[model samples]
Target: MSRFLFVVPPLAGHVNAAGAVARALLARGHDVAWVGPESALRRLLGDGVTVYPTGMRPYGGQRDRGARALRSLWEGFVLPFARFTRPAVARAVAAYRPDVVAVDQHALAGALVATAAGLPWASLAPQSMELTEPLRALPRVDAWIRANLAAMWCEAGLPAEEYVDPRFSPHLVLGFTTPALTGPAPFPPHYALVGPALDHDRPDEPDFPWAALDPRRRLVLVTMGTLAEDVARDFYPRLVAALAPLGDRVQAVIAAAPHTVPDPPPHVLVVPRAPVLELLPRVGAVICHAGLNTVCEALAYGIPLVMAPIKHDQPVTAAQVVAAGAGVRVRFGRSRPAELRAALTEVLDSPPYRAAAARVAESFAAAGGAAAAAIHLERLATS
Candidate 1:
């Protein structure tokens, strides 16, 4: 059996999807392991999983909207974290001796190491990021990103003549979305547009108050993901204000930092965390920051959305949702209560939104998900 090593970032959403695909590999009797932050892997993948320690440095402190956010993301977080973890990833490779490496799009070290070693690797890329080509209009920005990738290649001591963009693997690229959401793509033959990896093999989270849900009320789930908690401080109160006035028809369950929504009305439930996967089935709608993981998860359940995209590929992903008719978007920080309310009402009450979501869900099923990702990885390994 081929050995597969998954190299991912410390971020939970990245790990969650990787964990699903890793488990799928294991089920087929291949050996699978991970190289990333031990604490995060243990928290998400459980203590039993093998994780090579790559000392964690948190994401960049600068969280905002637009081009500035993109700069901070690469310079502050991606490139820095890549340099920090390169040694550990190389060490993990030497020790595990994997036949194939699976690398997240942001985990540049994996591609660098595998390529330098003359081993095949597959990019577990986000549809919102590489597949969407969000930076095509910003030619300078695109060149800036490529130059950094080239620098990282040079730092790995690989020859400049043999350079390739580490964020994308030449062997295979597994995207976490389908053309149904991304529109038709210009990607090559090796781009595998597997749907959201819904196997989500993590252990069950049982703490959510299922009884607190009102059977008669149309339920909405609001989550900005863990990374967006601090940035969401002001957004929550405005969100609360928007949803508060709509209590006659809707109640919201917000997964947020403590006290973000102070004195939340009985119709709203604000918690330190919520069992999102478990809660998705019961909810009719979602209000999110348009993080790809959240968007895919909400869509997997065929739930419509109201998106507020803050940074990076989120805005692009939000646009895709709007184009697909699965959701509507609002300004992240500047959205007034009336606007937020209107967007929420549009998705929650509109039949077209739910119908569109279901259509996307059907496409996702047809594309296959974790199983398809595993099949691609296996072929890359065996080929």
Candidate 2:
């Protein structure tokens, strides 16, 4: 059995995706370990797993508006994160000496260190951003990103010429979405489109009042994802008000920050968190921030969406959803209650949206999920 080390960022979504693959590897009789923030990994993967803590700073906040968003992503989070984690990851590698490393896409330092050490590594892309042409469309931005990555590699004493995109592994790249959701894209032979690695055995089921939900009314889930709680505060009330008109005909479940909305309308259920996987099966449509994980989860259950993209890869993911005929997109900051209600109504009332979502669901199932990801990692380790 080969020993595998997973290097991930502190982000919950990235950790969850990597954890799914780690569980699959362990089930296959391979020894697995993690190199990341210890507390966060323990919370996501449970206490049984071994972890080498490389505590790094959390991703800082970014401005939600203007052309500066991408700049802020690099300056505020990406570059700083890599710089901070590089030494820690290098230390972890020396101490653990695993056969192969599974590197989260955002954690570029892991890949750089592993490559420098001549160990096989795979890139875990929780989001499908690398598969899309967002950067290619903007050549200058793409060049700027590449330059920064090259500089980072050079500073770490690794060959800068070897760097193409740190997010794409030289050995393997595991994308967590299928072409059905992302549409067709030209990817390299090493890239594998393994669908979202959703953990089916997670024990933390939220105490949702499932019995209280009316079966007669169509259910809808509204969430701005984990990172957007502060940015989406003002938007939540508008969303609640918009969906309130449906009253008994439609029931809305809004997941926001704790105490963000004290008194929601009668038709809306405001909670700090919702067991989204458990709730998706009963819901007809989802209104979300177009986060890759949330979008994939909703689509996995064949539920259509109303996407409001705030920043980062959200706009790209939302575009894919709209292009696939599975959802509608709206501006997050400017969208009014009337617009949100109209978009939600379209997703819920239209049969085509449901059909498209079902089609994506089939593709996701075919992509083989955590099992497929494990197989690829195993191949990398043994090859």
Candidate 3:
């Protein structure tokens, strides 16, 4: 058995997906250690994988307000978080000397560390962050891009230009998205389009009015994801107000993060972030931030979506969903309660939307996620 190290940021989605990949490796008799975030250690340990906790920050605030989301992404991700993580990853890699490192595509620290160690690295992308080329076209983002590249350069012993150039080491990129949902053409040969990695078979103590769910009602699962609790605090209340009109017919299962719960709404069943796989299957539609994890989950379950693509790669992913005909988008900038309500209503009531989503679900079924990942990694070791 070969030693493998998998690096993931602390967020629930990232940890959950990466943990599954690690477990698959372990199950196949490989020595697996997941490195990143103290918060993830408990979960990884429970999944039967060794954990090397690195200090990391979860992005976004409990408030889902636009300003808070933007600030959180800036402070939690593009700033001090990445700066603080590099040395921690370097330390872990030096001590472990893993034969192969499977890292989240956005985990630049892990990528840098693997590059410096001269270890083969494969990207286990939880989102479409590294997929789109249009991100380079953003205004004034090049400065941050250059700074980030310089940091990566220092970490990997490469010139800064290597970061910007399209050519470099052959990276094996595996996306948590079906080919049906991704953008057209120009995909790198090393990149593999895998389906969403469903976290759990089912929840242990699945609660949230499941038994009391109104059969006549259309259930809408409104979530911003586990780490996005802060963002939900700001957004869920507004969302509740928007969907309040459809009260009896449309019951919302609002899974806000702990401490972010608003005043109870009669039509909204508020839970402190339940397992999404459990809740999503029962929902008729989902109103969520365009985090790739949530998007792919909704698609896998054949649930139509209305996305309010907030910070990071959300806008790009949301656009892809619309392009795929599986979902509709609530345009960013001055996005209001009425707009969200309208978008949700339109998608839920539309037959074509559901058909498109179900079609994508078929595509997802064909894409063997964890198993394909296992075979690929096993080959990496054998080769």
Candidate 4:
């Protein structure tokens, strides 16, 4: 059996996707291990899993939007993260001696180390941003990114010629989204759109008052994701006010930071966190910040969305949802209660939205998830 090692970032979402794929590989009787921040991996995959701890330096929170945010993301986090984790990843490779490494898109150090060690590696994209040509629109930004990657390669003792978009692996790049959700794009031949690797074996299920939800009303889940807790603090109150008008016709489940809202409306259920996979099936519609994980999870259950993109890859994901006819978009910062209510109403009242979401769901199912990713990685190792 071929041994596989997964190298992931400290971020929970990225780790979750990699962990799912790791679980799949283990199920196939292949030896699978992980290398990353021990805390993050343990939080996602549990303490039973084997993981080599890679030290991490947290990014100083910079709350910029648009182009500035993109710049900050690269300069502030990506570059530093790669440099900081390179030694740990290299040590892991030398000690573990895995046949192949599955590298998360954000964790460039893994790719560099694998290349330097002459090991086959695959890129695992937890989100769709890397699949699209994000830098095509801005040549200067593309150049800037390329220059930074080249510099990082040099520092890691790898040849600059070997560098070509660290976000993609030269041998194999696995995307966690279907073309239906990503729209028409010229992807490379080595890229496999393997859809989302959803974790079916969730060991811990949060206690949610399922019976408390109104059975008579259509349920709508309102969440801004984990990273957007600060943004949600401001957005949730408006969302609650917007959904208040629906009253008995529509019930809302808002996942907000603890005590963000002391007294929510009668129609709303405010929870610090909810079991999303458990809750998605029961909800008829979702109003969110268009996070890729949430979007794919919702579509997997054939639930429609009302997207309000705040930052990062959210706008791109929202655009894809709108293009695919699966959701409606509203302004995040400026949207009032009336506008939110209207958009939520449109998604719920329109049959076309549900139909389009079902189409994407079909595509997601056809594009094999964790199993397909494991097969591809196995082929890469054995080829």
Candidate 5:
């Protein structure tokens, strides 16, 4: 049997996606081991997989821009942590001696460890990292390059000369985006579009207050994902204020997150978390942060959206929604109550948004991400 080690950052989205791949690998009679933070241990355990805890929780904070987040990751996590864990990783490699490693793109420790061990490794991209023409044309090109260079130098102890080589490419680069959305890039031979792997076996069916939900009023589900956990803090109040005008005509369900539940607006139902798929079929529209998993989840249900993209790859992901005519993007600085209300109204009122969402839903159905990824990994392991 092929022995594989999958390393992931502590982030839920990363762990969730990696877990899907691990499960697929295990089902194919391969031995799978995950080396990362204890946060992922529970889920991996539930899947009957082995875990090697790294005692490192990745820094999870929202930056104003994607570039800033990347910079922070390099400085805060990679530089210090990779050096600290080098010995531990070395020992793990010697003990387990995995044949291959699949790791999240954000985590450099995995890359370093795998390279040190001389094992084949795959870099997994859970968000949009593919450099686009517009991004490349941005005026602050020099500043961006400087930051990236500085990051690389600090994290990997690499000078400019080292990065020029094609040896930097991982054995495989698995992209988690629908081929329909991302146009082709001239990637390496091993590059594979694995699409969004949202294989969450939702345990603890949270008692969704369906009886409390107003059947007469049109429902709208709002969320900003688990990382941006406390929705009640700042954004939730503003959203409630904006959507309050809809009143009895529209029933808003805000997953305010369990720990910090906000006092609900008159027309809104505040819940910790809802079975997104089960809830989406009854809802007219969704308002969310432009998280990749959330975006894909909404598309899977063919739910039109008003995307309030906060940070990271969100702006770009939101742009895709607008470009596809599937949803409206409520930009960072411009998400006032009135603007949100208008955007939500537009998505609900128009047939085009619904039609666009339906088209993408069809595309996703055709792609069959989970099944495809399972088949691919099975072949890779067996071969």
Candidate 6:
């Protein structure tokens, strides 16, 4: 069995998907470990895996949408965080000496360190931002991104001419999505679209009141994922109002801090956090911020969505959901209660939406999830 180290970002959404594959590696009698923010990994992964510590700074400032969000992420967070974590990543690589390094796309330091050390590595692309090429229409912006990547490559003291795109490893790239939802987007032959790496046994999932879920009424899940906390506070109230009227036929599980939706109606169950993976099968539809992990997880369970994208790749994922006929897209913040109500009702009551979700789920299962990803990684490690 080979030693595999996962170099992940501090972000919950990215880490969660990688965790699934890491566990898969473990299940096959391989050694699996993580290198990221110590506290966050501990919180998300528990004591099952070894974690190498790294510094983390909360991503401050406004989480804008579209081009602004994309640009701001690279400039404000990704580059700076990469620079900050570079030394620590190098140290982790030196000490662990793994056969293969699985690097998250946003965690540039991992790619840099692994490349510098001449170690085998694979790309862990949990987001659709680059895979779908949302910025292709804007040539200058895309060029600017390329320039930044090239500059970062040089900064790692690697010869500029020999630089490979760190976001995509030449050996393998594990995409946490499928063409069923992404439409006609083309990917390279080396890119493995392994659908959602659903970790059914993830640690540290928040407690939920299972008894409160009414089997008679259709269940809907409302969540903004981990990063959308700033907007979720205000958004929760609107969600409460929108779903309240549907109580007779629908019971909703709103995954928010109790204080965010303190006075939810009797029919609504509001929790600070939820074991969403376990809850998806029981849900008829999902209302979410379109975080890739949540979106893929819902679709994997054949649950339609009412997506209100907040920032980053969410808008793209939400667009894909709509194009796939599996969900409705309502504007985040700009959407009023009535709009939310209609979107939610549409996904819940529409037979076509459920059928589309089930079809996507079929595609996901065929795409091979954690098991396929682990096989690819194992091959890359010993090839």
Highest-TM-score candidate: 1
Query: How much is the lDDT of residue 239 in candidate 4?
Result: 80
How far residue 252's Cα lies from its native spot in candidate 3, in Å, is 1.3
Every candidate's CA RMSD: 1.3, 1.7, 3.5, 1.4, 3.7, 1.6
What TM-score goes with each of the models? 0.97, 0.95, 0.86, 0.96, 0.84, 0.96
Residues 83-127, model 4: lDDT tens digits: 888899999999999999999888898898998999999998887
The candidate that achieves the highest lDDT relative to the unseen native structure? 1
Off by over 4 Å in 2: 203-205
In every candidate, how many clashes are there?
Answer: 0, 0, 7, 0, 0, 0
Query: Candidate 5: which stretches are off by over 4 Å?
Result: 43-47, 57-70, 78-86, 130-169, 184-188, 203-207, 229-232, 257-262
Ranking by TM-score: 1, 4, 6, 2, 3, 5
lDDT agreement of model 6 with the native:
0.87
Scored against the true structure, residue 365 in model 6 reaches a CA lDDT of 99
The digit string of per-residue lDDT tens for model 2 on 140-239 reads: 7678888898888898887766665677788998999988977778878998988889886654446777777888899999888888877787788778
- Evaluated against the true structure, the overall lDDT of model 2 is 0.85
Q: Which consecutive 10 residues in model 2 have the weakest lDDT in total?
A: 62-71
> Model 2 clash pairs?
none
Stretches of candidate 4 exceeding 4 Å from the true structure: none
Which is the better candidate, 1 or 3, if ranked by lDDT?
1
lDDT per residue for candidate 1 within 326-383, as digits (tens), equals 9999999899999999998888889999999999999899988998899999999999
lDDT of 6 by residue, 285-313 (tens): 89998988999999999999999998777
* Candidate 5 local lDDT, residue 117: 57
Worst 10 residues of 5 by lDDT: 161-170
